[model samples]
Target: MRGPSAWSVADRELMAAFVSKVNGSAFCIGAHSATAERAYQDGAKVRAVLTDLDSAPVAEGLRATLRMLGTLTGAGTVSADDMREVLSAGVTRDQIGDALAVCAAFDTTNRLADAFGFESPGPGGFEAGADHLLKRGYR
Candidate 1:
């Protein structure tokens, strides 16, 4: 699994959480929720972003990046110009790549989990993974 880099771990978890929510994968959503909460001091911020990305209080660049990810998830295409626009917004290349990677990975994972009929184990399912992520620091 890809780990968070220079970007806030909270942001990475939020991305996973958002993708899981979009895919309606209860397992992933629960897991990511716990991971996010464990990784960030401001867990509520992650929840807020997961709840309504547009209204989430995050940096303008990150918000734009999330919007880009949403478009990619829905449309399956991101123009070169669109890439340039995001890059110009001060988003590093690695950050963009990592976000895209997380989005793509969750897309596949969500499908598999749902196709296999896996259900979320409720709120605490994230504990195991959260332990590892938390030990690694908040990023």
Candidate 2:
């Protein structure tokens, strides 16, 4: 499903990392950010997205999706204009749906992980885990 989306794998993973950060789930932030970094083959893109989404080196479509996801992390509902932003960026309805699915799933996972006191491995562990996931997949 994610493979066919307009947003690349790195973009989706970066969104997950961003959502984790917004939710303050340290475990998820470490894990997802490492995954995004590994998918991007480095940390620069991930850093850009996490540090300043507006200035991230991604396309307008991805930037809009990221912005929508950021708003999604809040307690309020997503407005039609948010969807418009994504659409105006050339993201298809299907693509937006995929992106929102990723964000929503991560939102639940981050909360669960935090509520359960899931401890993150250190930086080394994050990279190692990401490598394992890339090689073996989440299944």
Pick out the ten consecutive residues of candidate 1 with the lowest summed lDDT.
Answer: 1-10
TM-score of each: 0.82, 0.93
Off by over 4 Å in 2: 1-3
RMSD for each model, in Å, please? Answer: 3.1, 1.4
Please report, in order, the local distance difference test score of every candidate based on alpha carbons.
0.78, 0.86
Model 1 stretches with alpha carbons more than 4 Å out: 1-4, 136-139
Residues 1-139, candidate 1, lDDT per residue (tens digit)?
3465657777787777787887778888888878877777677777887788779878877887877877777777888877887788899999899889889988898889889988666666567777776676435
Model number with the top TM-score? 2
Give the least accurate 10-residue stretch of model 2, judged by summed lDDT. 1-10
Model 1 lDDT, full chain set: 0.78
Per-residue C-alpha lDDT of model 2 across residues 2-30, encoded as one tens digit per residue: 45776777777888899898888999999
